[model samples]
Target: MNSETTNPKHGALPPWNVDELPAPLPFSLRNALRTIGPGAILLVGAIGMGEWIAGPLFVVQHGRSVLWIATLAFVLQSLLNLEAVRYTLYTGEPVLTGFMRMRPGSKVWGFFYALAGFAQLGMPAAAAGCAGVAFAMLQGRAPTDGDASMVTWITVAIVLVSAVVLASGKKVERLLERLSWMMILFIFSFLLWVNFTFVPLKDWISTSAGFLSFGSIPENVDFVMLAVFAALAGSGGIGNLAIANWFRDKGFGMASKTGNMGGVWSTEQTLAPVGRVFPINAENLKRWRDWWRYAIIDQSGLWMLGCIVGMFLMTNLAASLFQPGMQVSGVAAGVFQAAEMRKLWEGFWYLALMNGFWILFSTTLTNVDVLARVVADMAWAGGAVPKKMPVGRLYGLLLLGFTVIACFGAFLGDAKLLLMILGATAAPITAFSALQILRLNTTLLPPELRPPLWRKIALVLTALFYGAISVAMFHQIFSR
Candidate 1:
């Protein structure tokens, strides 16, 4: 067969001529460094204002002992993220999709995912709102009443972020990844600097420095406590899974590559003018499965897992730094604001904390949309929505519309008040977790990838962590 006669076509390659190929051994060191991808970007998209504010605040308040709490929180939160990966890898189902696959006869299981997409409608807007406020704060232009409302600034910031994301397409990822790396560097820099510069580091870091025991609490009860916990750990909180599931649903998760059915490309020695021809046989074909492979190759893929832990530690840090007794919302919103815009620009450092807000809330803008999509996906899969409509898109539209209405409602009524006054917002998730555990136990996952014994043990441990937090929250609330 002549090489000139056979050109490339379809998924099939030309016959593998071993004699025509060159021997492999020429990878440049510089070329090898260029292959990273979107994992870090995803982390940046998620680990925002929360870390900058909460993590730093905790460090300031709790002293160095805050490290223990931050570490534990990271581990616990990361385990859930790990579950997100595990659930999505082989099956390609995200949290909402997983909810759809729940047991048929289970008690009230369907409701576990009914409103999953509610966040989609407003998350982007909410995130933008926060980012704008943070951005203003960072720029030393913290909004005061008549100068410029927080709402307007947030709206503008969100629009800008969205425009950037939309315009950049794939390129936005590279920028995001770079920024997230910077955030990590910032955290480490502070950690290192604090470790060295602070004089009390040795004395404070000792074993005698202990956690507040239950007995340390005054033997008192407060009724409003449970609601605080409910607010903290509500349905919209476990967003790690919601966003991750989105990436999975988008085909970023592990996939088993079906074997190549065409002629294989083989390497071999070749003559000068004429390229050689080789055999076309079953042996030449290759089959490859891409399951769990995303973990290795995709840069933006697994990086979110690490960031989730970072954010969790950040939460603990915040709590440690600024627990109730030490401060109660008195952190001035306009600490260094000048009436003039010129002064704001002159004080660039004022905007340092703005990135923190940008980090969490910027990504939150699109998150609710993904959540809405997830809910729709689950709804369609469960037959709650008509098949003709393609539930995901239909529900996404509905969720979007509803969010618009909700935002309007925010003007009419107190959005924050409306959000908390509703219910034990986490009930849907608690239900889902229970069902997920049961499903895992009853052989839902493949045997080989079924959670190991330690993971199984961790299920209870994780649940207890949540429970303990809940109880502690209630105790604190009622005692107050």
Candidate 2:
């Protein structure tokens, strides 16, 4: 057995490693796509709710001028994500765990991280509630008067079913992975087809230019626009941190050595031991290089591509289909437009409604799962939970707690407002996570494992970019 030291002060475990770990396969398009699982999961969690609701909501109001911001956000987030995974690859610990290791230690930062996480508790609730709106609409309960009784009931039903699915066992990850891909294929393809078939060539051209242009926000920008911008910028919010855990669970790089937290029904209680650092050597260096290459492909190909494409398509569809001065409200706005589009083409309405519902519900599922995982990781890393208590039990408790919060929000009956409030709250958390990840990558890793000078510069800019947006969002909120 390997001898290891545990830092009693901060609950820090010894560095984790395993002999004979899985090596990344040779680089190829096929191989890259095969490694698409984590990033794809990130994509679904990121774009599912925001693109459907905020993308169109913004485009309908501002005419795609703000899309450039969304694109820029994706680019910056990709870098932040790359840096985050780097620490995980080297350490076999979640990125947030790295944050816990910062100056004052896990206990101090874990409190702040947990506090930030509470702000995001509204996200999954808002997502499930939006999906409930779509479900209500599908059942012919028009939200013309903003009555959400049907939506409330449907949201509760979705949360309950999702809880059951999660608690079903250790197989939840695989099940969610498969379900995410199916949703992506069906929803993305349908949106692309609809936009191409219905949206005019000139509108598409104009919107494409808008996406590339750094156009001005309308002088009349309101709380709605600020909220939309915040939502688009952060996209995935605190849940993005979950990407590192997903990478670990997928057995990427060093994470393979650190066993993953089991699913909701798992009875395993004790956390896996954190491995020790591999002594710098030619073989280990080569392994790091191979893992870095794999990380780039996975981050660029899936996370960046999925978010950018999904946002662009959704925005374009909104700009093409809805004229200025039209009232656009959250998921209902998209679903109703699809209903209108169906009048033009038979069988189109179902596709639109399905896409809308799938996006929101899928996000709800992933958000709940990701939050549970993150919190559980924090609990274990911080030594807050007793070793005798099973991880699955903690995960289940948190998941159920979030679902209950969501049910309460659903009954409150304002999906759009609820989502906006949640989105605004997410902006600062995004900035915090980005900044923390940058610090961890720069200071924690060995000089050889640290990102190069150019990436270091880019990471700084990424953190600042998020910081500026977050500050501006708060300014807007307070000024209002």
Best by lDDT: 2
Which window of ten consecutive residues has the lowest lDDT sum in model 2? 1-10
What's the C-alpha lDDT at position 234 in model 2? 35
Task: Give per-model TM-scores.
Answer: 0.59, 0.91
All predictions: root-mean-square deviation over Cα?
Answer: 12.4, 3.4
lDDT of 1 by residue, 327-355 (tens): 21212221211122223354433333443
In candidate 1, stretches whose alpha carbon ends up further than 4 angstroms from where it belongs are 1-42, 57-67, 105-110, 116-139, 144-237, 250-354, 384-399, 402-406, 409-438, 474-480
Error of 1 at 15 (Å): 38
Query: Model 1 Cα displacement at 476 (Å)?
Result: 5.3
lDDT per residue as tens, model 2, 1-480: 112212112234443443543567776788867765777777777775577776677768767776787877777778878888888887777888888878787788878877677666544454544455466456654354354565567677777777777777575556677778888898789888988888898888888887787746776766445555645543546766777877777777767766676777677753464533454556777877888788887788777888878877887877777776577544364365565676787576666777777777777777778777788778877789876777667878888887787667666645666666667766667777776776777666666677888787776776676677667777877887
lDDT assessment of candidate 2 = 0.69
**TM-score, candidate number 1:** 0.59
